[model samples]
Structure formats: C-alpha cells, structure tokens
Target: MAKNGKKMETQRSVDQEVKAICDIMRRGNCAGAMQYVPELTWILFLRILDEMEEQERQAAEAVGAAFAPSIEAPYRWSDWAAPGSEFRTELFEKGQGNVFAFVNGPAYGEDNKTSLLPYLKNLEKRPNATAKQKVISEVISGVDRVRIDTERNFLDVLDKVDAITSAAIDDTHVFTLSQVYEGLLLKMGEKGNDGGQFFTPREVIRAIVRVIDPSVGETIYDPGCGTGGFLAQAFEYMTGPKNEKIKSADDLSVLKRDTFWGREKDNVVYPIALANLILHGIDKPNLWHGNTLTDQVGYGGLFEGAPPQFDVILSNPPFGGKEGKDAQSKFDYKTGATQVLFLQHVIANLKKKGRCGIVLDEGLLFRTNEDAFVKTKRKLLDDCNVWCIVSLPGGVFTSAGAGVKTNLVFFTKGERTKRIWYYDLTDIKVLKKTPLVSKHFDEFFKLLPKKEESELSWFVDLDERRKKAAAEASPFKKEAERHARAAAQWNEKLKELKKAKPKKAPAIEKAEAKQKAEAKAARLAAGKAKEIEDAVYDLKAVNPNRKPEVDTRTPEDLLDLIEAKGREIAKVLFALRQ
Candidate 1:
C-alpha cells in the first residue's frame, strides 16, 4: 500500500509540473499555446529522451552488454540544461576560450562545434547513425533557436520539464503527458493553424483504430499523419489487454521500431508528430517528412526506399483543399481536391489484402456529376471491398476546425465491393460544445458486420444498384402501375362481399369465420412478400433522374395499404364460402 501511494504521488507531481510549465510559457508571452507547445515539445522531448537513455544504459549494464549512447556527451540534456553545471560553471562562466561562443552562438559548428543547431543538423549525415539519432536531428533541424526572450523564463521551463522523471515512462504516467500534448495540439487545431489539415479529433481517431483492429506484427501507416494520432492509437490498441498477437520481447521491439510509419507535409507539425509518438513509447517511428500527395521521384529519392506498403492504414486526410497541378499530375484520375489525391495514394500504396479506415467528407460518396469524382469512386469499388460507411453527425468536427459532414469508410484491398453498408448519424445533433462520443457509434458498430436494416442503417448492393442506374429512364413506372391495379381489384371485391346477405344458421357462420382466419393468414404473408419486393423498386424512384412524385409513398407506407386490403379480401373469401 505504501509503495502504491508513493507511485500515485509521483504521478501527480509530474502532471502538475507539466501544467506549471505550460502556464509559465503562456505568461512569458511565448505567442500563446500554439507557439509555446512546439517549444515545450522539444524541451520535453530532449528531457524524456535523456531519461529513457539513462534507463537503457542502466539495463544494459545489468545485463553486461556494452551500450553506446545516441547523443554524444557534450550535447546530452544533462550537459547544458542544468544551472551551474559542468559546461556552465567549469567551461563557460570563467571566460574559457570559445566555450560560450561555441555553445549558443549562430555559426557553422565546425572544428570543435559552434552551437546546438549546427551540431543537430550535422548528425543527419553522420556515418553509421542510429535511427534514434536521426529522429533527434530531424526534430531539431526544424526548430528555431529558443524564441523565449528572457533567460529566467527559459531556465524555469527547463526546471519544470526536468521534474518529469524517468518514472514517467511507465505506461500509466506516460499517457498523462500524451494527453497534455494532445490538448495543446487541439488548441493549435482550434485556431486553424495550417488550415487545420492535420488535426483529427481524438474521439474520431479512436473509433477508426478500434474498427481497423491492427494486429501486433502488422505494419500501420498514415499518409497524412497529423501529429501521429492514428499511429499512437494503433500502438495503444496492440499493447492493450485485448491484443494476443504480441507475445514476446522481440515482438514488442518490432512494434516499437518498425510497426508504425507515417508521412507529414507540414514542417511545423512534423516535430509535434515525432514528440507525440515518442511519448506513446515508440522508440523509433519511421515518419518521413514530405508531401504524401506528390509522387516519389525514384527509388530512395523522396521516400527512403521504394514506396512503403502497409498492412493497415488509418487516416483522416485534409478535406476540400485543392492540390497543385504537380500533385494532380501524379494520380491516374487527376483532381485538384486534396482528399482525392490522398484516396488515390492510399489505394495504390496498400499491400494486397491491406485493410484501411479513412475519414472523408460526404461529397466523395454521392458526387456523380464530375468525371474525376465518378472515376475515383469507381476505382475504389473495383479495387477494394468497401464494407462499411458510418456517416457522422454534422458539426462533429467543428471543434477541430472542421464543420463538414464526414463519414468513416472501412475497406480492404484486393476484393471488388459487392455491397456497401451505410449508417447515418446525421440527425443525432453533434455540436462544437457537445460533440460526438463513442456512444454515438454504438449502434453503428453493432449493425456494421450484420448489415441489418434499421431506421438509420441500410445496404446497397452494387450489382443491383448499377442496373437501377441504367434503368433510370422509367425504373419504377411498371411497378407503380401493377400495384395500383391490385389495389383497385381488391377494393371491388370487398364492396361485393359487403353487399351480399349473411347466413342465418349458427353452424354455417362459425365455419365461415374459420375459413376467413385461414384466408387472412395467407393474404398477410403474401402482402409482406410483395412489400419486400417493392422496397427495391421504391429505391429506384430515388434516383436523381426519376421524379419523386412518381412514387411519393415509401415502401413501409405501401405495405400498410397492402395489409389493409388483404383483410378486406379475406372477408370477401368468407362470404363466398357461406
């Protein structure tokens, strides 16, 4: 009990320290949460990396294995960050030759090294560099020198960051930092930074991950990996109790080192993605910093090697943004829309049988007017089994700086879609203040694989759908005429039966009643069968070319009319028996 209490106290301390650091950065006028979050991310990253390296070193020594540090001694977090420490007190404060000038001055870090930035950039080309070293260099190369004007503020931020101890790497405490970082990213997204292109809401991210169900060893990639939310959640899902595919340390090492990959175009957002993954316990995430929409020049030119293929993909690519001619030229079905290009990129890069869950605007589903849009859907259906589309309520993403109605599309490569299941949550009233929660998707998840018909859930078989589209000249006209004649004949029969006299004998009346009951059951069954057949015809009238007034009644309402006529026809049959 005492040990448990101690752990709780430590966790609280780390959480409060992070909150305090964010408060200090905000008070120091570091340009609000948006600017300071990135600054904070770097400091926190370096500190966290230092702590993790120390842990690794200690573990290696316990096992009698030689360990080489990723960062050289002079540039490690402990070397320069602490006050009155070795570099500050022994080497720099006493006017040691070229010490201060070399550490912070803006110049090419040559001979012995000039500044932090230069050394970090130079690590990219270092011979036999580890993946960890490359990640650190990539993060630092994008960051400008500390923008905080006051030395006191900078040092204070460092002190608070250092308080987040090595214990934070524990699964329980580490997720606290991930949550804090996500909140800051949410603020950036809310402010419409980078047109809110990379920010997918955390709730939406979880739903996609849960549905995609990535296995432990399977590779997961996100092309437009904004802050690495999908990758992080995939990690969480595989490591959670429900995962059985991961059974050994080597399997875990595979997850940490190579299971996840991503690409991001925005340089400002790239560091945040790296930090996010690191916080989630991914030791070395294979994230390429480039525009995924643009085609790679050649082998090892843009992408590290040939295009990376993945077993599962989860992404919410930017919607409605227009790409340039250069980007559009890369896709076979050329379009200026950014999502269209991403769709093409995802389809092309997925391995055979790769499963993907993507968030897209509603326009992609029903846009049949344009050639590019039509062809894109055509290719999607022909090349993949698009099993489900869950339409989210409107304003579900207003908090994330997007107000467009969106749908989550789940598909697997290598199988042409035979039927598509759709669930509509549009009427559920999701707002910026009261946005969508997991409960909003409960019904969707329940009805998804079953493809059951509910008020909001329906299925569309592509083969029958194609035939109806082809018959739009007069699709429902013949069915409408046949049903009208049936109704008229039933009405006449009922009138004739009501006009006839009833039998006077009690025995005859009882026999007639039994006959009527049997006839009623048969008529009711036939009516239901007809209703099922007419539902498809009713859908045909919904085609854009067909007039709505041609079949104003829905299939359900028409079924009610048929059942009413069936009862009257049963009464007429009883009169004939008498």
Candidate 2:
C-alpha cells in the first residue's frame, strides 16, 4: 500500500511529527501542550476519520455497493482541507465570506450550506444518525471554536497533520498511526503537565496487557479508561504478532468493532480516549462519556450499547481521586476514595470466569484504617481469585506526576482468593529518565506462572490466614451476641419497670443504656478480631525469606561514627573561619 512502491515513512517518528504540529500551534494562541493537544486531538481525529471514510467508500465502490460516508461531500477532509478543495476554495463565500468566520460558523448564506463545525455539531440531530455520527458530535462538543487564533497558523497545523497516514508509515515496522498519538499523550502527561491523571506509563499498560493476555473473542472493558490506554493496549496484544488466534475476518471484526468498551466522565479525557482507540484501529470504541460510579450523564450514546459485563477488564483508575455523596450512592461499600469505588465497580462489572489486571495504589493495598477500604478488599478476595499481586517500585508513576507506590493485582471471577503470589520490585528505584521498564518485570513474567517463590517473590495462603482469624473471632462474636441479648433483656425490663412504676423508668433506662453500650463495645471487639486477617490483606511484597539489612555496628562504634561526622563538619567550619 506504499505510494510509488516506495515505503513512505514520516519525516521522523510519529512523536516528532506530532511535536512539529504542536510547535506550529505554539506560534499561535495555544501556549502549552495541554492547551494545544486537546485542540490538536479533534483535528487529528477528523483527519484520520476522513481517510477511514474514504477507504470505506472505496471498498463499497469496489464491490458495487451503495456508499454513504459518516461525513458527506464538503465536510470530508479532502473536501475542506486538501489542496484545491472545492469548499475550501470558496471559504470566503461559504464561511461567511471569511475563512476564520467558519471556525465557529454561521455559514448560512444564500446557498444555505453549513460550514465545518456547525455541520459536525449537527450530525447527531440528523434523522437516524449512526453511532459514529453521534460520536463525532460529542468528540468536538467541547470545542466551541478553533483555539489556534489565526487562519494561517491553523492551516499550517492541518498541512503537517495531513502528512500522517497509513501509507506514510514505514512498511518495515509493524505499525499503527496510534503510536504517533501515544507520543503526544506522553507529552501531555510529562512531569509538569496537567494531564497526569489521564496518563499511565506506556510500559505499565504493556505489562498489564501482556499478563491479562486478552484474546480475540473476549470482550475487553475499562471502567475508567483514561485516554483508553488499557483498551488500546489490549487491542494491540490481541492482534499483534503473538496472537495467532485471529484467523478469520469475523474474529478481527469482533476485535475491531464490537470488543472494546469503556466509561470516562471528564469531558476533555472522554473525547481523547475515543480518538486514541480509533487510531489503534478499533472501529467502534464503545466508550461512554460519564461518571462510572454515579448517575450523572455527559454523553452515554456510545456507552449505552456496551454489554453490562465484559470478559476482560484492564484499567488503572485515577489515584487519590475524590468523589461526592452522589457518586457513592450507587455502591454498597461507600467511600470517597476514587480507586476504592472503581475497585467495586470493576468487580461488579466482570463476567463469570472473567479475568482482570488492574493497577491499585499501594496505600489502598495496605491501609486497614478505612472501613470501606477493608470491606472492598475482603469483597475482592471473597468474590475473585486474586492470584497475583506485584509490588511496583516507588516512582513507577513519577513520570505521570504520580509518585505513589503502586501494585498490580491480577484476578479472575467465579472463585475466591485462597492465596496470593506476590512479586516485589520495590527495591528498584525509578527516576524520570530511568523508569520502570519491561526488563524490570522480566523476573516477574518468568516467575508468575506456577506461582514460583524467590527472593523477589512469595505467596500468602489467604484461606489459611482468614480461617485462623475467623476461629479466633468466633468466641468474641459469641460473647458479643450474649451482651447484645442481655442488652435487649434490659430494654424489656426497662419497659416493664416503666409500666409498673413510672418513677423507676429513668433509673432502668440508665442501666439499659449501659448494657447497650457494652454490647456495642463487644461487637467492635469482634470486628477488630476479624480485622487481623483484613490487615494481612495489606499484601505488601515484603519478602520474608530475604535476608534483612541489619546495622552491624554496636553502640560504641555508632557513637564514634556520629562524633567523627560532627568533627568533620566542625573542621570544615574552622577552615572557613581561618
């Protein structure tokens, strides 16, 4: 498919070309990557979409089938942005007699033809508009007008973007245009950017996808698809060289048009995610643009058709995200922690025997102080076989501006977690340049199967630990119940006393309140007893088999070292004074 039988490659990697585009935006009003990327996302999306529609039209024509595009004649990329494009040539006449006038259009003239933005924004209202049309409407729903601030600068951006195409990619590399877009996303998530929450490191996405190993037939979903990374990676894994299961058109069809689904509430992120997956070659991204945990709606048209449950789920929900009471009202275990609520949502949305690999905050793994956190972890263990937990190195998310210690939990529905195999990578320090790479997880992938134990890995028999805790708590629960029964008896006695002698009622009521307080105390004791097991659920991969790093020196030696360091500092001060 290379033009002229010479493989066309971009001037550089896709990232470089995207940078070139952003650089042009920078010359105009778009000052930062955050500002330019969103404006660029829709532009790039429309460009790819037009090419894809052109291909569809060609295919339809080849077979002599009736052909209709999602975006018709004058609005298509070739019709508006290409050199010598008819509508573009007439922009002075069509766009209210000025090119910039069409940016936020009232392109209605004597001819009554709509300009680009108005046409795109009006697609959904057309009679029996397709899903793609509705999606097109929402992707640009947030863009009131062009942000680039001038006609010449915006045209330059289009010219640079127009060069990116399937035909322009190097044939030698197993490539997708999505790789280029990913680089733009990385810039958006770089150390200082405001888009950190939406970005997960690329290596993290790849590792989770490799472990989950989603296949062609299975439906993959991400409840919080930040830029659709999980869904995009899963698509790559299923269709990549490793996966040979895709033998027929139907299999690829299922993967492309029917398999991927997700939900995101942020308006900026929601559209970006849809574009990301589409670039990854997923035809129908099936993404819902709304809060996953709440009833509030943004645009649910694409998501409304997603199956209630999916066969595979992969995601890293936003860490330390906060939700209000309205978001918490839907789940049984109420919590303001976004990660905790997303965990419940993930568990609730998995199909029987379904598999999931999710990134969770390390604090969520270990903290037993929050009742919601503990209950959710317990519910996870009760409902799924959490076969593996990988303790990620510190700064795994530093590149994304998240310095939080994190963990990867792999689980399957339809079974309970008996034991959890843990692989520790905490000792590997990650810096901005030197990040958590695939080689860091080489040992992990090697030891993951058979649940092997090493200095870096170990397993915990959760079933045994819980059994021990339950046995210890059994007597406590029984004693608590006895106290509760006695409290009830006191309540009845107080009632009887009140009926017999009204004057005695206050004193009896005081005694009854004391009994009830004891009962409450006893119940708390029983919960604390059971909580011992839940505390262990803080499954940090602190490998017990590994030798401890002990301070070898005794007190005299330690004191000598401290004095020596103090003397050295004083010596430096003395030299300075002299």
Candidate 3:
C-alpha cells in the first residue's frame, strides 16, 4: 500500500511538471519548442492516453470483467520510467522500424497488418533515435515531477503552457501559445509591409473587448483576422470563469463550437489561427481561408453564403498604404487596397444591429481621395451608431519602424449616430525609448470614459459640426478685422510721434569732443611706451651672445624655433587686446 501511494505520488508530481511545461509554452515559448513539437506532442498524448486507459482498466477490474491495457507493455509508463533503460533500444535497436506504429494502435499481424507496431519499430531505428529518445525522456521526466492533475485544472494547465510559450517568444507573444496552437494565423503580407495593417496591439484588443463586451452564444468574427488576436480575446472574454454568472453553459459551449468565425487571405497563418482556436478549446471553429472582401461565407442575410451572422466584429484591417505585385486584383477599392476593402467586408459581415470595433488610420476619417469609398464609409456611420472614436498615440508600432497614428472606431449597426464620442489620446506617451517597457495603456485605460461622463471624452453632435462648418464661409474674416484695427492704431501713433519731435545739440558736445581727443592722445602715448618695453625685453633679439650649436642644427629646426618665438609674441599681444 505504501509503494502504491509512492507511485501515485510520483505520477502526481509528473502531472504538475507537465502543467508547468505547458504553462511555459502558454507564455509564448512554443517557437523555441518547435524543434520538440513532434516529440512533445507525441509523449504528452501518450501519457494522457495511458492515464485514461489505466482508469478504464481499473474500472473494468472492479466490475469483475477481463481487461487489458490498449498500449503494449514496453511503451507503458512504468516500463518507460525504469532508470537508464532505453525504451528505444527494445522497440527499434536493429533494422526495426517506427515505434509509434504498434504503440499507437494495435499489434502488428497478418489480419491487423495496419497496426502501429511496425511504425513504432521503424521510428526507434531512425538515425537520430537516441537523441529523439533522450529529448522525449527528459521532457517526460520533467513533466512527471509536476502533479498537474491534482495541483491544477486542465484550463490552468493550458494557461501555464500558454504563459511559458508566450514568455519565450519576443514581440509575437501577445496571443498566448494556446491561442497560437488553437487558431491564430500570422502571415507575412505583401513584401512584409501589410503585416502591420492587421497586427492589433494588445491594448487595442483589450479596449475593443471591453467596449463590445462579447457575451455568450453571440457569434464573433474578424473578416481580416491577422493573427487571431482579436477573436481569441473575444473567446476568452465570453468563456472565462469571470463571466460565468452572465453566461450560461449552453451559451459558452455554443461560443466555443459555433460562435467564432474568421477569414484570412494568407494560407500560412490559417493553421496558426486554427491552432489558436483549438488551444482555446474551440472545436471546429467556422474559420475560413479566403478573401472576405470578395468571397462570401454565408452567415445570416449578412452575406450571400451563410445564415448565422456575427453579433460582434472586431478587426485591425491592414492599413491601406501601398500594395505589392502579389496584391489582389479584383478589389474595387484597390487604390486604397487593404483598409478600404476590409471596411466593406466588415460592413457586409456584420449582422443587423451588430456591434463592431475597428482600428483605422486617421486618414480614413477625412480622406478626400476615393469619394465613393469615403461616401460609403460616411453613410455607414450615419446609418449606424458611431459610438466612439479613440485616437491612439503614435509610436505604438515603433519596433516595426512604422509610427502611423491610428484610431479605434466603435459602431453599432441599425442605430442612430446623433452624437459621436471622441477621445483624443494622440498626444499621450504610448512608447518609450525601449518599445517594450512603456506603460501608456495604464493611464489611458484609467482616463477612458465609462458609461458615465468624464473630462477626457465628450460627445459631439454631428448636426452641430455641420453647423460650424457651414458658418465658416469667410474663414479669414476675424484675422482681417484684427489686422485692420492694428493698422489704424499704427497710423495714430505715427501722427503723435511726428508732433512730439524735438531738441538740439548743446555746449556739452564740445567738451565731450575735447575729452575724446585727449583720451586718444593718452592711449597713443601708453601704446608707444608698451612697444618700447616689449622691444627691450625681447630675449630672442637681445640674446646675440648666447648663439651656439648652429652646426648641429638643421635649417628646418632653426626656422621652426623662429616660428615658435613669433607665435609666442603674437599670443602676448592678443591677450593684452582681450
């Protein structure tokens, strides 16, 4: 009984270690673990399966039924744990093939020839088998020391993994490792420049999440989901335990399985996003790989393709600056390629009365180019509730070397936009000398306007702005009036000064002129005396008796000495003048 307890305790410790390893991945270190992915995933899957199988076997024994562990004995946890025992050798030491084959499924046989045993045998004989086994064993032992099942829940384990992985990554750590694994795609868009267009800052994601407040059961979508940051945040907001009171179990499940959807143009990041969603525990998300601007994914009457529309849409569309050779040709708003098309896609994807939080460059707010596009955007604003526009500070993407100022525009479809709330945070300090060490978001969040009124934000009526614009026909009238008043004042002053002009020279002028002449004569006499004294004290000219060593000295040396003496005399004269 004591030995059994010790074994169980050891197993519990291993689970904790596994949790810690995964937690490290969650912090953004998965990229470092990329080399170990195949091994780590395989080992972890095996361990989990082993645990599940053990529970099944114990239950079967208790019920008086004959039972056998599905996994072969050689690959069992106990056999693998024997100190210094190389499981790889037993599985594939000679010409034997993959080990995972037999251990993965059933035994190799003529009737069941497709068993995993052959593959496992082959895998053990691979050239790097020893190294692979070592890595696998080390990871297993490391995780084995942690009692994950007893000390932490599954979600907590996932979070720890996410933290670990994210911590390992550099700038791309915003989306947790699970998010990356579950379903967040990152692609190098057009010459790598357009990537920033869809790169959403974490603070921006939080702000959008706060404003949209995505509830359970409501579908959320990002038509231009770059790395799935926005969608992942929405997922967390809806399913996180903090929201349990407000969200029902059924609603949360719906959110996990059916509510989240996204579309991406690049194929590379598609897997990333899918993995991100999966890591977040969303099974089979409705994400698609296509140009949302041109393609349809039929969600409700929102688009031609689907019936269930999204209740919330959050996106940081690529900034419409310039496009490369591989850019999409069918886009009508190709002049402002990225952002304009994404705006249209967002509008098309949103369900009636749906809310949207989008980040756009400030130019979109007042660009005269592309009149039709501008008109469409403005009309959408007018038809909807353009709730707020939070202007973000520059230098948010300083690491990318692009400092384009951006703004978050929140709107709700089918609602009247009588007043638009504007929060001007353009002058806020968002970045420091080191891009990663700044604390701009803290103060910004504090000053953010709640549902209540605040000094940092105010609502401006559209009608009042129109009135102000119309009343400013003669823009320079006030300046012209002020200039005319200043000219009149100058004329009046000139007339008064002319009448007050006066006076003549007196006898003091003659005395002053005589004093000046006497002072000049005295200065001349003193200068002559100083000249005579300098001549008398001139050592180079007076020391004729000290002449020697002329035969040993070169002409150049004599000239240099003469030059040095002349410079010294000049220096004395210059100092006296000062």
Candidate 4:
C-alpha cells in the first residue's frame, strides 16, 4: 500500500510539471526562448524510456518470460545524473553522433544494458556540471518512481515536457524583452539597411490581408518578406481554430511548412523572420536570405518558368533607391534599377490565375519613363483582373519619417478586367501625431463595400471606357473640349454680373413730394419680372442649361435678345445708367 501511494504521488507530480511547461512555452518570449532548456528534452525522454524498459523486465521476471535490455547503461538519465563523477565530460567528448548512438542503443533495445553513458558524460564537462547533475538526478529519480503506463498516454507526458521547458524559459516575459530589443534597433536609426522602407505599417498589413483573403493550403509568398509580419498574419488567419470544422490536419501541415515562403535581403531582418515564424507556430519555415528580385534560388528565371507559383502574392517592396549601372544592366525590364524591377518581378512570380495585392507609390499608376515598363504594366492589367486601388492617408509612415502617399492595388492574373474598384481612403482623416495606430484601418474597413455595393462607393468600368475611346477615336479630346466650354461659360456669366447697374426710384405724388419714396422703382420692376418668370416656369423647370446657352452666344445675339424682350427691362436699366 505504501509503495502504491508513492507511485501515485510521483505520477501526479510529473503530470503537473508537464502542464506548467507547455503553458510557459505558449506565453513566453519568442526570441531565444528555446535556448534555456536546450538539453532538457533529451534527458526527460531518456528517463521515461528507461522506466518502461525496466517495467517490462520486472513483469517478464515475474511471469518467467525471457527479457532483454534495449538501451545501453551509460546512455540512461540515471547514469548521467547519478552522483556524477566524470560522466558529463565523457558525453561531450563523444560529440553529437556518439550521443545519438548511446541514447538509441541499450535502454531502447531488446536488451536494456546500454546505459545513458552519453548524457552522463556530457553533464560532467559542462560548466558547473556538478550542480546541474545534482538537480537533474533528483528530478529523474522522482520521475522514475512513478509506476504509470506512460506508453498508453505518452502525449500527456510529452505535453508536460513541452510546457515545463517552455515555462523555464518564460516566453511571456521574453516577449517584453523582444519589444525592448526592437525599440533599441529602432533607436539605432540605421539607414541603407533599408529598415525604414522595409517596415510595413501593421494597419496596412491587416488591410492587405483583409482584401486578399488568402485561404489555407494555398502557397502564400512575400518576396520582400520584411520581418515576416505578413506571412505571420496569413498563418494566423489559416490556422485559427474558429474554422475547425473546415480546417484539417493536412491544412495545418501545409501552412506550417509547405504553403509559406519568404525572402529577405537584409541580414538584419533575416533573424527577425525566423523569430516571427517560430512565434507564429511555424516550426519548419521555408525562409531564405537573398534579394528575391535578383537571386537565382528556388526558381531561376528572368520572367518565364518561375518555380512554385503562388496563389497569393503580397509585398511592400523598398521604395526610393537608385540602382547602379551594373545592377540596372542585370534587369530584363527597361526601368533597370528602380523599385519598378520589384513590381515586374512580383508579376513574373505570380501564377497565371493567382491574385496579388501590393503597396506602391501613387506615381506607379501614372508614370511616363521607360515606355516598355508602362506598356508591360498595361498589358498585364489588360490580360488580368485589375480589381481595386485604395489610396492611403498621408503620414501613414510617420514612424519611418517618410510622408509619401501610398496606394494598395488588388489584381488577379488571367481575367479580363472590365472595371477597377477605387477607394479614396486619403480624404479620410487618419493621423493625429507622431505615431500612427491601427484605428485608421478600422474606418477604412468599415467603409469598404462588399462585392455588391450599396453606398459610399462606385466602380469605374475601364473596358467600356476603352471601347468607347476606340469607337470615337478621340474621346479624351472630346472630354477636354467639354471642360473648356464649361470654363468659358462661367467667365461670361461673371462678366455680365460685373457690368449690371442699380435702378432709380419711381416718381412720387406731388402732395407726398416732401416724403422721399422709400422703395426704388427699379426694385419694383425687377420683382415684377421675377414674378412673371416664376409663373411662366415652375421651380423644377428652371433650366440649368440656360447659363451655358446664354454665355456661349456672340455679344450681338445677346444684345438683340435683350431688346426683343420686354422694353421695361431696358428702360429701367437705361434710366438708372443716366
């Protein structure tokens, strides 16, 4: 009875320890949090495996069944942590290959003779190995005393290991540390590192994600994957358990390793990408360090035959950099070394029917240099579904000290675009002071119309406009003329108003001659004319086109028309002039 109680206590303690570790890992600091318990996992796994083997050996002895030891003696957790003398040093000298060999040999085999020799040897040589061995020995002895069937529910134990190790490092506290590190990096104020240009506003990122709506299991690539924020958001959207009925194991796995890809050129941000991936639960990410626009990695091509075509391509490439002659010469496009190269590269990388969302300077929409580049862009749009253009508010990048107006363009390849949706978010008041927050995105998202519009938004049909332009052969010219005519008519009306004169008072009765007439005769005449006009036409019938017709006529035509009209108008005006 005493032995059973001790075993129960041991099992309960181990279970509790595992739960605590997992909680820590989930909430701990993301960067370098895994470093704290680098070897803790190897030790825990060994102790559990040894206990199982020992149980089988004891059970076989009772049943008179033949048993064999699977693991070697020195490789067991007990051997390493046991009142250690020189075991830790021996493990380190054996290196990684021997460590694996010793761990896999005896305690895990048909014969449980191979000890945890490698682990003991490793602990012996570590700085302060004596202290580490003491603590590890106590922990392992306590774990071994548990007579639980770990195999039936190994996951529970695994969870505990994960939790405890995570807690030991404490990620929640670590995240604060990470923020401090990022603040320091910002304070360093390094340029040409392209830190300012590469850092995409979080609100902008969220907006892009909302518009694109990338689905799970689809390959999402960000060629200029700065700090991996965009990819992280994509992962969160796909993996979020809200859609558990729709999400599957395959979906999660694809998102974890296969579906995501990113490339960053700056060395400073490469580690940031890795750290971000880990924080987002992407254990084995396919991230690379290279200038994706120019590098020949993964898929090598100037334009055709790009590897691993993406379903969604999103990026905020660096702006305002002059490419050198050598760099410019390398590009296939006419723009040579400007940020336009990235635009072209993004287009090239996208799958034929893939969708893309990018943030670019407003000038890219209408720039006249490198006709080939412009023509290429137009051709791409002509063959694709040019969906929406959102003009962002100014001071969006106040933190970066760049006040350039940026726009988000949404387009899909392989579909003929009839109209492009344009959202003028620029007019919306978004900034308050130095640092911009996510509140700006809230209003923009609110005002954004669904596919079937109701209000506050309209579509511009490019296809109809182009067809009309081609039919007329000069629609733009005609439009220009219409504007000019409108301006001329406005000027003529202003000139006539400037030349008009006030009217004189009417003659008074001889008896009332001492009392000057309070009302002018000209005002009475004007009121009478207004009444007649009002009677002739109702308010709704008042002609807006009347001013254009009156102003467009020659000076002689206007004078003749005035003379033909009631002579009271001319008499009153002529007397007032006198």
The candidate that achieves the highest TM-score relative to the unseen native structure: 2
lDDT of 3 by residue, 1-578 (tens): 12222221233333444445555444533333322232234333344344445776898999999876544566564344222347544544433333333344455323455343233334424465542232222223222222223212322333333223222333232333353332212222212344444456566687788778887767788877865778887877776634454446677667666677777765434444544554555544556666565563322111223345678899887775554433435443454456766676677668888999988776666554454355556556666787777767777654333566677888999875767666655546655343322254554456555633354455666655444543452333444444445545555544554455462234334434544554455455444433332222111111122325457889898999999999999999999999
Model 1 Cα shift for residue 499 (angstroms): 81
Clashes of each: 1, 1, 81, 51
TM-score (all chains, Cα) for each model: 0.75, 0.88, 0.52, 0.50
Off by over 4 Å in 3: 1-198, 241-243, 296-308, 321-334, 400-402, 432-455, 468-578
Candidate 2 residue 152 Cα shift, in angstroms, is: 1.4
- For residues 71-107, write the lDDT of model 2, one tens digit per residue: 9876788877775677677874444336666556757
Instruction: Please give the CA lDDT of all the candidate structures.
Output: 0.72, 0.83, 0.52, 0.53
* Per-residue C-alpha lDDT of model 1 across residues 437-519, encoded as one tens digit per residue: 88888887787667787777777787786655446524244444455455555555555555567734554455445555545
Candidate 2 deviant stretches above 4 angstroms: 1-14, 84-97, 108-112, 171-175, 241-245, 481-524, 550-578
Model 4 misplaced stretches (Cα beyond 4 Å) = 1-194, 241-246, 296-307, 325-332, 429-439, 442-456, 468-578
Best model number under lDDT: 2
Candidates sorted by lDDT, best first: 2, 1, 4, 3
